[model samples]
Target chain A: MTVSDIQKLLNAKVLSCNEKLNMEVTNAFASDMMSDCLAFAKDANVLITGLCNPQVMRTAELLDIECIIFIKGKEPTDSMITLAQNNGICVLMSEYCMFETAGILFKTGEIGGATVGC
Target chain B: MAADNTIKLHYDVPNDDFTRAGEASSDLKGKLKQMGISPDAIRKVSIALYEGEINMVIHANGGYIDAEISENGLKLVLCDTGPGINDIVQATQAGFSTALEQTRMLGFGAGMGLPNMLQNTDDMIIDSIVGVGTTITMFIKM
Candidate 1:
C-alpha cells in the first residue's frame, strides 16, 4: 500500500512531508512504546503510534520507517513536524483510536507479522 | 582497509533530555550513508546505537558516545557516569527496566533497550562499577 492509501483508509490528515505520500509501504506496526517499536518492528515501514514527540520521528529515521500515523486524533507539535520534514518522514493524524486503526489496517492485510515478546 | 582509514565520531549525550536523545545516532546514520555503507549494516548500527543513546539519557543521566566506522564495520563505545546496573544478567532481560515512572511517560523505558542493542549488534560488552559508571562497547561487523 501507499501512504495515500493509508491516509484515505484511516481518514487521516497529512501533517508534514506530503510529498512522500506516493511512497510504498508494505507493513505497519502499532505501539505507543518507542522501545518495543524499536525492538520488534522489523521491516515495518509505517508506524501507527499515539505518541506525539520528536523521538517518534527519530525512531522512524533509525528504523527506516517512511511514515508515522498518529492515532486517537493526537496532533504533532511544530517541532515534531519539522523533525519529520527533516528526516523525510510523512506524518499523518488519524481520529480513530489505536485499536480501531490497527484493526482497519490489519483487515486490509497491510499490517505485518506479529512481533514476538522480546 | 587499515585502522588509519577509520572515521571516528564523538557525541556528548545530555542528561534527562529525552528530546535530544537520538541526535547522535541520526548524525551517525547520515555519515554512514554518505560513506556508502551497506543498508543492512547501517540499519543495524543505527538501531543499536540509538538504543544505547536512549539508555544513556534515561538511565545514566547522560553519557558520551564514540563511534568508529571502517570498511570492516562499526564499533560504538558509550560511557556514562550515573548509577550503574546492579545486575547485568537481569538487566539484559527483555522486560527488566529500572527507569522511573516519568521516563515511562516519554514512551520509552519498556526494558527493551539493552536487549534490542544486543539483538542488532554482532558483539557487545558491558563494564560497570556500582555508584561509578558503565561503559558499553558494541560492534557490528560488515
Candidate 2:
C-alpha cells in the first residue's frame, strides 16, 4: 500500500515529507518500544508508535523506515518533525488508538511485520 | 593521522544531553555513505553503533567511541567509567534493563541495546569491572 492510503485509512495528518505520500509501503509494526522497531523494522516499513520523540526519528533513519504513524492523537514535536524532514521520512499522526489504527490497516492488507517475514 | 590506509576516529558522548545520544552514530553513518560502503554493511554498523551510543548515554553517564575503518573491517571500542556492570551476562540479555523510569519514558531502557549491538556485529566483546568502567569492542568485516 502507498503512504497516502495509510493517511486516509487512519485520517492521519502528514506532519512532514508530504511529497513522498505516494511511496509504497509493504507492512507495518506498532509498538511504543523503540528497541523493538530497531531490531525488527526493515527498510520501507511503516513504524506505528504512541511514543513521540526525536529518538524515534533517529531509529527510523538507521533502519530506513519509510513512514511513521503516531496513533492515539500523539503528535510529534517540532524537533521530531525537523529530524523526519532531514531524513526524508514521512511523519503522520492518527486520531485513532493503536488497536483501531492497526486493525484498519490490517483489514486493508497492510499486515504487521512481525506476523509476516521482514 | 599517522596511517594512510586507515581512518581512525573518536567521538565523545555526553550523558548530560539525552536528546543528543545518536550524534556519533549518525556521523558515522554519513561518513560510511560517502565512502561507498555496501548498503548492508552500513545498515548493520549504524544500528549497532547507535545502540551502543544510547547505552553509554543512558547507563554510563558518558563515554567515547573509537573507530577504525579500512579494507580489513570496522572496529569500534566504547568505554565508560561510571558504575560498571556487575553482571555482564544479564546485561546482555534482551528485556533486561537497569535504566531509570525517566529513561524508559523517553522510549529507551528496553534492555535491547546490548542485544542489538550483538545482533548487528559479526564479532563482539565486553569487559567491565565493578566501580571501575566498562568497555565494549565490536568488529564487522567487509
Candidate 3:
C-alpha cells in the first residue's frame, strides 16, 4: 500500500509529506516503544506509534522506517514534523486509536513484512 | 585500517541532552557504511550500541563510547558514571527497567534496552560499581 492509501483507508490527515503521498509501503509495525521497533524492524516499514516526540523520528531514521502514523488523534509537534520531512519520511495523523489503525493497515494487506524478531 | 587492525572511532556522550542521544551512533553508522563494512555487521552494531548509548545517557548521566573496527569484528565499549546497577541479573531480564515515567512517556524504558543490546550483539560484558559507575563491552564479529 502507499502512503496515500493509508491515509484514505484510515481517513488520516497528511500532517506532513503532502507531496510524497504516493510512496509505497510494503509493511507496517505499530508500537509506542521506540526500542522495540529499533530492535525488531527490518528494511523499510511504516511505524504506527502513539508516542509524540523527536526521538520517534530519530528511531525511524536509524531503522529507515518509511512512514509514520500517529494514532489516537495525536499530532506531531513542529520539530517532529520538520525532522520527518527532512528525513524524507512521510508523517500521517489519524483519529483512530492504535488498535484500529493497525487493524486497518493489516487488513488492507500492509502486513508485517519487515522480518522483525528473526 | 591500522596494523592488524582497521578504523577506530571514539565519542564522548553527554548525558544532559536527551535530544542528542543518537548522534554518535548515527555518525558511526555513516562512517561504517563509507568504510564498506557489511550491512549486517553495521546493523547489529548500530542497534546494540545505540541502545547502550541511550541507556548510558538516560540512566548513567553520560560517559564515553569507543568503537574499533577490524577485519575480524567490531568492538564497542561503553563506560558511564551514574547510578550503577545493584542487581545485574535482574537488570538483564528482558522486562526490567528503571527509567523514569517521563522517559517511558517518550517511548523508552520498557526494560528492553539491555536485553535488546544483548540480543543484537554477539557477545556482551557489563561491569559496575553500585555507587560509582558501570562499564559495558560488546562485540559483533564480522
Candidate 4:
C-alpha cells in the first residue's frame, strides 16, 4: 500500500511528504525500540512507532525509511516534525495504539518483512 | 583498489545523556559518504557502529569509539570503562539485558545490540574484564 492509502485507511493527516503519497510500500515494522528496528528491518518503507524522539527519525534515516506513522495518538513535537521535514520523511498520526495499529496494518495485508534471527 | 589511506575519528561517549546517542555513527556515516565509500559498506558499518555507540551509553556509563576508515573497509574500536560483562556467552544471548526499567521505557535494552553488531559486521572481537571495562572491535569490508 501507499502512504496515501494508509492515510485514508486510518484517517490520518499527511503532516508531510504529500508529494510522495503514491509511493508503494510492501511491508511495515512497528516497534518502540529503535535498536530492534535498525537491527532487523530491511526493505520496509513504513515505520509504525510510538516513540516520540529525534532518534526515531535518525533510525528511520539509517534504514532509508520514507514514512513514519505515529501510533497511540502520539503527535511528534515541533522539533521532531522539523527533523522529519528536513529528512524528507513523511509523517502521520493514528489514534490506534501500537498493537491495534499493527494489527490493522497486518490485517490489511502488510506482512512482516523478515525476522531477526535469535 | 590501491594502498589504504587511514582516516581515524574519535568520539567520547557521554553516558549521562540518552538523547544524544548515535551521534558518532551518524557523523561517521556522513564522513564515509563524503569520502565516496560505497553505500553497502556504509550501511553495514553505520548499523554496527551505531549499536555499539548505543550500548556504550546504555550499559558502560560512557566510553570511546575510534573509527578507522581505509580502502579495504571501516574498522571501529569501541572501549568502555563501565562495569564489564560477567558472562560473554549469556550477554551475547538475545533478550538478556541488564538495562534498567527507564532505559527500556526509552525503547532500548532489548539485548540485541551486541548480536546485531555481530550480524551486521564482517568481523567482530569482544574483550571484557568484569568490573573494569569492555572493548569491542568490528570491521565491515568496503
Point to the candidate with the largest TM-score.
1
TM-score of chain B of each: 0.97, 0.95, 0.94, 0.93
Per-residue CA lDDT of model 4 for B35-118, tens digit only, reads 888887778887888888888988888899998877777888999998999998888888888889887787878888888888
lDDT per residue (tens digit) for residues B46-105 in model 3: 788779878987898899998888877888999998989999999999879989998898
Q: Go through the candidates in order and give the clash count of each.
A: 0, 0, 1, 0
Residue-wise C-alpha lDDT for candidate 4, range A1-118, written one tens digit per residue:
8888888888887777788888887778888998789877876688999998877887877777899999877888887787778878999999888887777777887555544452
DockQ of each: 0.86, 0.75, 0.69, 0.66
- B51-111: candidate 1 lDDT, tens digit per residue: 9999999888999999888787888999999899899999999999988888788888888
Candidate 4: misplaced stretches above 4 Å? A107-118, B1-4
Report candidate 2's fraction of native contacts. Answer: 0.67
In model 3, pairs of residues that clash are: B1-B6
Q: For candidate 1, lDDT tens digit of each residue in A2-92? A: 8998899988999988888998888788898998888788778889898888889999989888899999899999988999898899999
What lDDT score goes with residue A10 in model 1? 89
Model 4's chain B TM-score?
0.93
CAPRI quality of model 1: high
The local lDDT score (0 to 100) that residue A117 gets in candidate 4 is 59
Compare candidates 2 and 4 on DockQ and give the better one: 2
Fraction of true contacts kept, per model? 0.90, 0.67, 0.56, 0.62
Model 2 C-alpha lDDT per residue in residues A28-104, reported as the tens digit of each score: 88878887777776644788899988898988888778799998889888988998999999999999998898889
For DockQ, candidate 3 versus 4, the one ahead is 3
